[model samples]
Target: MTRILVTGGAGYIGSIATHMLLEAGYEVSVLDDLSTGHKDAIDTRARFVEGSILDSDALTAALSNCSAVMHFAGKSLVGESVEKPDLYMQVNVEGSTKLLDAMKVAGIKDIVFSSSAATYGQPGDAPISEQSPTKPTNPYGVTKLKVDELLASRAVTDGIAAVSLRYFNVAGALQTSDGWLAERHNPETHLIPNIFKATPSAPLQVFGTDWPTPDNTCIRDYVHVLDLIDGHISALSIMKPGTYQVLNLGSGSGYSVREVIDTASRVAGRVMPSVDVARRAGDPAVLVASIEKAKKVLNWSPKRDLNQIMQDVVSSGA
Candidate 1:
């Protein structure tokens, strides 16, 4: 079996990817500090190594004898990045470099990095493609884009095959209930889960209903967790030495905040309460990905829609 080392394999998307890898007959080893990752989310098939990506020794050990590394460990909050820019740089940028160094020592060249659509910042057009200009509006995005640059340079210089999948808003849950991984951040900022948790009783808060969108609410491209993992796995299989690629992973459809809440309410068989509020800083009016490159290269497309995304979230009971 191909040995794959996944950083943050106990976290939301990482854990789901790890599960998929194991199911596909890969020997998976996970390296995570469990800072934001839940222990229960890890698949039993994967070997879990408790550590941070900042620790080169631990990373080296984890990468030893592995065929490739899937990096998902990093600070991911946009608002928090604005408040603590240094932390985002230290973890997302510096730590990613450290992981690369470890891979260099281990002679492992292939890497699938988990990037974000935030790297594009506020795109001037909807359905932004991989060729879109990356003018990140926040520190979180800045760090991710910097890592992409680093990976590109390293791929040319060190002969590393790297593919960064710039994901939009990753919502929904894994299909199986046996290993359900839900969003559980301290002071959570994601709209879907927060709205799901506050439905029927508490009113979901909608920020800045004055944006230039259809409902004056921020619109985001939602990708199912399963679809996102499928893209990662496909990228991992096709990555060639000295090759570098960046592709957007999203459903190519944008949904407003109100639409999401309404969909969730319908899925849950209950009416969800919500109120409009002032827009928050660094919040883009709309973020919809153009997934044509992903389809052309990886032959991947989102099989699930927004309604399926909401149903998955509701089913997870997370």
Candidate 2:
């Protein structure tokens, strides 16, 4: 079996992807610091090492003999990144450098990095494509874009092949026995999860209703976690040497903040809350994906829709 090392394999998307990797007959090992990832999400079939990417010793041990590394560990909150830019750089940029160094030393030529759509930072149009200009407005996006540049440069100089899968809003749970890898950050900011948890009596807070879109709220492309994982695997399996590619992963449709809340209310069988708040700084009107490259390259199409996303997420009881 091909040996794959998944960083942050116990976290939300990482854990689900690890399970899929194991199911596909690969020998999977997870390296996580448990900072935001849960230990229980790990599958018993795969080996687990409790470590962070910052620790070179731990990374070296986990990466040894691994055929490829699927990097998913990082600080991902945009709001938090604005507040703590240093933390984002430490984990996303510096930690990624350490992993790349270790991969070089170990001669691991394949890498599938977990990038974000935040890298686009309010592009000129909807359905953002790979060619879209990446002028990230926030530190979180800036760091991811920087890492993508580093990986591409490394791929050119070295023989390492890397593909950065830029994901939009990843929602829903893994189709597993373990409860859905729910969002449980210190300050939970995602729309779907927060809407699900809100009581009918309490109004759900909607940010920025003065944007140029149909609804003043921000618009985003939502991809089920399963589809996101599948995209990662597809990228890793098909990537050729001397190539560094960046692909956007999301359902080709966009949903506004109000649309998401309404859908969640229906799925949860409860009246959800609504509270229109001030527009957040740097909030873009619409952030959707153009998955033409993904469909052509990976031969992948998202099987789940927004309703499915809401249903699966509510069923997970996260």
Candidate 3:
């Protein structure tokens, strides 16, 4: 079995990726600090190294005997990134630089990164493609864009095989032999989870109701965690040495805040409470990915829709 190192394999998406990689007959090693991930979410079968990507020693230890890496460890909150730009730069940019440096030392040539659609920032009404302008508005998006640039440069200089899967709003969960690997973010900044968590006492805050969107709310494209991982695996299989590729992984469609609320209400058979508040500091008015590149390159498309995402989140009791 090919050994792959999964950074941040204890978080929502990383944990699911670890489980799926193991099930697909690959030897997996997970490196996570549990700073924002739960320890119990890790699969016991794979080796777990409790550490952060910022630590060079941890990166070396985790990269032992690994042929490739699936990079997912980073600080990823838009609001928080706006507050702490320097921290985002440190963890997302500097830490990734360390990972790339360590990969050079370990003779690892392949990497699949968990990039975000935030790199597109605020674009035109059309769905964002890999060729779109990457003028990120927030510090978080800026850091991701910087990493993508770094990977592109390294691909040419070091002959590193790199795939940066730029994801939109990812939702839903996966059930493994262990349990459901669901979104357990503290403060729950995501829309789908916050929608389910809404209540009358402390209603969910709907950020930016005055956007240019049709529904006057921020619009985002969401993909299931399962589908996202499938794209990653496909990327891993088709990596070409001395090449860097970036693909958008999303449903190729979008849903507004109100639309999601209405959908959740229908799915749950009750009104999900929410309140409209001021716009968030670094959020784009709309961010939907054009996954045509992903389809052509990875031969993959998302199978789940918004309703299914809502249903699955509900099923997971998130």
Best candidate according to lDDT:
3
Q: Please provide, for model 3 over 83-141, each residue's C-alpha lDDT reduced to its tens digit, 9 standing for 90 to 100.
A: 99999999999999999999999999999998888888888747899899888888899
Q: Candidate 3 deviates by what RMSD?
A: 1.4
List model 2 lDDT by residue over 226-289, tens digit each. Answer: 8888888888778778889998899989999988988887888776878888987777788899
Please state every model's RMSD to the true fold in angstroms: 1.4, 1.4, 1.4
Q: Report the CA-based lDDT of candidate 2 relative to the real structure.
A: 0.88
| Clash count list over all predictions | 1, 4, 0
lDDT values of the candidates? 0.88, 0.88, 0.91
The segments of candidate 3 whose C-alpha lies over 4 angstroms from its true place after superposition are: 208-212
Worst 10-residue lDDT window for candidate 3 reads: 280-289
Q: Ten residues in a row with the worst lDDT in model 2? A: 177-186
Clashing pairs in 1: 208-279
What root-mean-square deviation over C-alphas does model 2 reach? 1.4
